[model samples]
Target: MKKVLILALLLISTVSFAQTISGKAYYQSKTTVDTDQFGGGEMSEEMKKQIMERMKSFLEKTYILTFSGSESIYKEQEKLEAGSGFGGMGAMMGSFSAGAQYKNLKTNQILEEREFFGKKFLINDTITNLEWEVGKESKQIGQYLAIKATAVKKIDPNDFEMARPRGRRGERGRNRDAEEDSEKVADTTQTESEDPFDQIEIPKQVIVTAWFTPQIPVANGPGEYAGLPGLILELNVERTTILCSKITLNTKETESIEAPNKGEEVTRAEYNKIIKEKMEEMREQFRGRGGRGGGRGRFGGF
Candidate 1:
């Protein structure tokens, strides 16, 4: 009996010391445009069809997420695009210069690193910031323990908009006039705010709720997300849910976990300038097209 008791205690200790977690992340999101912009008129059937087709193309692209503990990689196909084709066409008309492929537009990003309170955690680093939250509810995810947690995530619309190239530049005076006109239109469309959240457009704010399990004992999750008290076994954002599809623990570990060095090496200001220039170039191409009445938009063939 004593030997059996010692064996059980050893097993418990071993389980407590183990570290690692793995999972699959599923996500869903919709993209919509303001109908009041451009030519303010009722949308035609042809316009609606074009917008839907564009949205579908945008969502199908994939994104990559990496972190210190684990990485989540997947793709989101285009879902819906409402409003008029004029605005959509104006937005993308500038891609002619960069050889921009519509397929290259990524609506999502792969899980990268999560920084919390100045501490950095990395995959393959072995030492991670993940810790299990005690006394939390758990749900069975396959053979793993899934704990629940919520986080209110705020994203800047400009960040998302900049992901895709903007089309051509208008004449100096014309551009300023257009800008002023757009602001006026935006002011008129503002809805009365009942709640602080309602003041912002629905696409602008997103709340991310996640489920994790101490089974991995590392407070890590996919993308640049972390700081929960456990390894995130599942995450739900918008209407999509990412669950732990698979896990490998106490196996032969290979390779070291490190931070990823991707994306353009530019400051925020510089990046903005580049985007503006590209948009201007696109605008020039649009004007050269001899108006929108011609055969499809710039991307019609592709």
Candidate 2:
């Protein structure tokens, strides 16, 4: 009994000490898209450039993740406004936003702040444990030795997030939204054949190549990426590549890291249900407009 008690206390002390080692990692993410798919095959160079330019809002972004031990706070950095001179059509582009993601590996939970239709939501859910295969390959990322690791993830089509569909003008993605309401709601519904997301086509598997350093000793990275032996300095998911631009370790100030509690608390399954319902609601509102039973509504709404 005495030996067991001493061992337990040592383990507890080790955990507490690990939590004190904190750092800030700045990551820049970039994604590429085929223009022909969105532009209907043949298009002039100018048209392709314009489309790609608009897509920069979704394809390219930057984020800062403050982390220590099993906790992390990942948030997108402020972006500068840029777009074509066109009146208001620039707002129709899709957005790629994961919002402020707060993760606690100790509890296997993630609290992500999301916005839709001008409302903010706090999605509280369990962390997804992605199976990663560590490789013998090694590389240097910003003076830190990083080992290569890969994960094959099966993505869900229904999990796709479209940019905010604004009318004629304004910012895309999470650019248009509200702060947070204390009211919390959880969705209680099972996946059915009538699920709207069933219509979306999802790929079977996606390859994720990441480079992490055991030196950092934190299984954290940008977006929903983790499960490595160390901090991920670079990650390639599908067509998007996130690279760590800068890393500042053990700052003079210890930042506070906690779960976001402002919006509704719902599980990942529940959040997916909410998104599907909201999309169906939008579709129903436009049902009468030249589409099957009615008009085309606003042709490219989402």
Candidate 3:
């Protein structure tokens, strides 16, 4: 009877632990944009500074991550409206993907609804288990004490819009099948302008240093990071850093957290394949203006 009682108590505790905890973490992120890299064009210096300022404001924004121990939803906070963008950039006609990401920690599943050039794409994939080396260093992020952790992550070069050349205004998603292009072997003699991804010699890798607090014992984080002992309040991915400003934890877990079932369903790998092809097409448009080695860009993406 003693053993039976002990087993029942253990099971009850486990079930209670699995229950979702309602929590919201606010994060402020900032990234540097090198406008000089895109300069040496016909635009005046004053115009360049104006464009850079706009880009910086766009890059530095606040995000709220509402999560429990098991699932989370990451989205940006709404801000004031701005006048016309520089070259109508980030408009409805623009081509880019910035979407809400929902993840299930226990099942190792993620569903991100991305908007690319007037189309919606659902990226469904299993999270890659990252191996982090926990460190003894500790620092205070706001009120909670945080411990340091580090990891090296491999990044696909094609994932960065800065790495690829963007096409003209109003250009959007290409419906061309990547498999059709993949079936034909790439020409060795000709440059891989149409397939610029092939031109990337090495895959980019970044050192990720994250800080989490054990005060909240949950494997919850922002973006594509998790599996830590506590909530990740601060994350430094390469040159970019996202730091949590505030956190509100409530037991009112009434909201339902579910994976997004909309958009054209595609695995992460397949979606990347489409991006590679589209990037190739964009690169070709650049080559048509002048060869790759020739001139500077008028404007660039971050």
TM-score of each: 0.43, 0.72, 0.70
- Predicted model with the maximum TM-score: 2
Model 2: residues >4 Å from true position, as ranges?
1-17, 80-97, 162-200, 251-253, 284-287, 291-302
Find the 10 residues in a row with the least total lDDT in model 1: 97-106
Candidate 3 residue spans exceeding 4 A from truth: 1-20, 35-48, 79-94, 161-203, 252-254, 289-302
Residue 253 in candidate 2, Cα distance off native in Å? 5.8
* Candidate topping lDDT: 3
Candidate 2 per-residue lDDT, tens place, 182-280, comes to 101101110111222222334546778999987776767787777666788999875678999999888355677876777677777777677666666
Report the C-alpha lDDT of model 3 over 151-204, residue by residue, as the tens digit: 888776656433422221112334324522532334331233323333223236
The full ranking of all candidates by lDDT, starting with the best, is 3, 2, 1
Ten consecutive residues with minimal summed lDDT in candidate 2? 179-188
Clashes of 3: 0
User: What lDDT is reached at residue 227 by model 2?
Assistant: 61
**Residue 187 C-alpha lDDT in model 2:** 11
Given candidate 2, what's the lDDT at residue 167? 20
Q: Write the per-residue lDDT of candidate 1 for residues 155-178, one digit (tens) a residue.
A: 444332323211112123457566
